[model samples]
Target: MSGQLFVIGLGPGNASQVTPEASHAVAEAEFFFGYGPYVDRLELRPDQTRIASDNREELSRANAALQRAAEGAKVAVVSGGDPGVFAMAAAVCEAIEKGPVEWRDIDLTIIPGVTAMLAVAARIGAPLGHDFCTISLSDNLKPWAVIERRLEAAASAGFVIALYNPISKARPWQLGSAFEILRRHLPGDTPVIFGRAAGRPDERIEIVKLEQADPAKADMATCVMIGSPETSIVERAHKPPLVYTPRFSTESSQ
Candidate 1:
């Protein structure tokens, strides 16, 4: 009998945020494969085996899961947040595309979860109520030039931007460079949010103006969100401030 491969998204870090389908998929799998930290989060059954690897070994991890499925082991390749959103789903699909014809016979399912951007938006307000785009500031897989172009284009288009993989020890300067590009098109007082480790114990949400959004406040665990021109803030007495983009567009009103 042919075995199955489930690419599951663990959501942020909170177990409650995970979808029922994704949880079921994790429970059903006989073998789990993922980056070590993500794999460590799962509540594995006694009958299950885990294949954990370093964060950068996505392709190899996907391949190993595929190999296990081909050998009749039900496998789950897990990712943090939504697997399809800058995670293992794409890597698994790419592996299947490049593998042998027999690889096509494996049952593959992509289980979605609450992506970090959306979770962060929910915790703050609906900053993404209007048009928006997501970008990864990491240049590990793509060139910095390509990332720069996308950042400039997004800023020019006035799209509320959600930045993933914003900064790390090796890529410390990219977030600063991206902010500089945004400053060229956006006002200095525009709203920006630094949502770090959302849903985790150390989770923090910092709201600041673009001028105050220092890249030093971010790390690999942070998701930086920049508001579009249409975005606005509403303050309440004894309540945290709310930031949101208006649903209606001025273009339609004209």
Candidate 2:
């Protein structure tokens, strides 16, 4: 009797953003495995055990969780945002693929949660209202040239771009380089949003133009959204501006 493995997304820092399904899954889990901060988010009963590892150790964490599950323990692996979005879900699947045959026998359930891009988009207006694509700026798994090429391709295609893992202490220059690439493809006046820790107590959302965007505004916690050429902003009296991309494109008018 192989045990069950639940891959859960805890959502962006806010408790309210956590889905009920995820909550239920957490309750049913006897063992939890995840990054330290993400696992700490859960209010597990004393009986439940948490095994936390470094955020960068995704594969190792997945293997450990699978090993426990194969031992007939109901285990849960948690991610801060959507587990499927550059998170633990993929790692677990990869582990199962290369792991022992018994690892594949464990029943797996994936519970979704609000990701950073969605949370950030909701904070302002609908910057993602139109065509959009997300790209992670972290070059840890991929090469920097690959990231730059994708940024250029996404920008040239006029897709609203949401960047994850935008800037970290270790890789500070990449975000600035990304902005330079965007400036070549996007308009100087295009809206760029820097949403940090969306839905959390220390949340900060800043909107700027492409030319004015400073890389210093972002950190590892920030989700950077660069609007398409078709995106627009609506100004309000004594209120923050609302930014949105029109639903209909110029080609649609034809």
Candidate 3:
């Protein structure tokens, strides 16, 4: 019999953010496969085998997990955030669809966790209270033109935008390029949030205007949230400002 495969999201690299269901899934696994950092984060049992790979090997990692599961090994494939969001879940799905026919019968479960954008949003207030869209700024998978078109479309649609994989060593200028496109459709003073290492010890949150967003401050660990025109910021005397996008486009009468 084929063993089960669980694609678990280890939310924002914090113990508290991981769901109990995800914990249980981990406990049940005899083998774990994931990016090296995420694999290192787990408290592995003595009997569990750890399959760690460097970044950008998502497809290979997913195949490894699936093959082991097919061999009757209870396996867990870990992703940094909710696996469905630009993580292992999609890769696993695609692999199953394209791989050997028997792979389809293998039991699979995806355990969700707190995605980075949601964790960052909570820390900054309710910037995602209304309609929102997420986009990855990495051009490694798709063409830069596609990203620009999506940015323009999201800006024109006035959706709260949460950007993932905003900047990295190899693609440092994408964030700045994104801001340039967005500013054409969004106001110069629109609220932009930079949440770095959101739930970890070195977490940092910065609020800035669209025109003032410095791409230099961003890295791969950061998630950038850009508020819609209706988004509001509330200042407090002794606390960080609260940023939120309202549920309604305009005020409603009582």
**Best-fitting candidate, scored by lDDT:** 2
- The lDDT for every candidate, in the order shown, is 0.92, 0.96, 0.93
* Per-residue lDDT over 129-185 for candidate 2, one digit per residue giving the tens place of the 0 to 100 score: 999999999999999999999999999889999999998989999999999999999
Better of 2 and 3 by TM-score: 2
For model 2, the superposed segments whose C-alpha errors exceed 4 Å read 251-254
Candidates ranked, most accurate by TM-score first: 2, 1, 3
lDDT of 2: 0.96
The RMSD of every model to the true structure, in order and in angstroms, is 1.2, 1.2, 2.2
Clashing pairs in 3: none
Query: What TM-score does structure 1 among the candidates reach?
Result: 0.98
For candidate 3, the clash count comes to 0
Q: Which stretches of candidate 1 lie over 4 Å from their true place?
A: 251-254
Question: Lowest-scoring 10 consecutive residues by lDDT in candidate 2?
Answer: 245-254
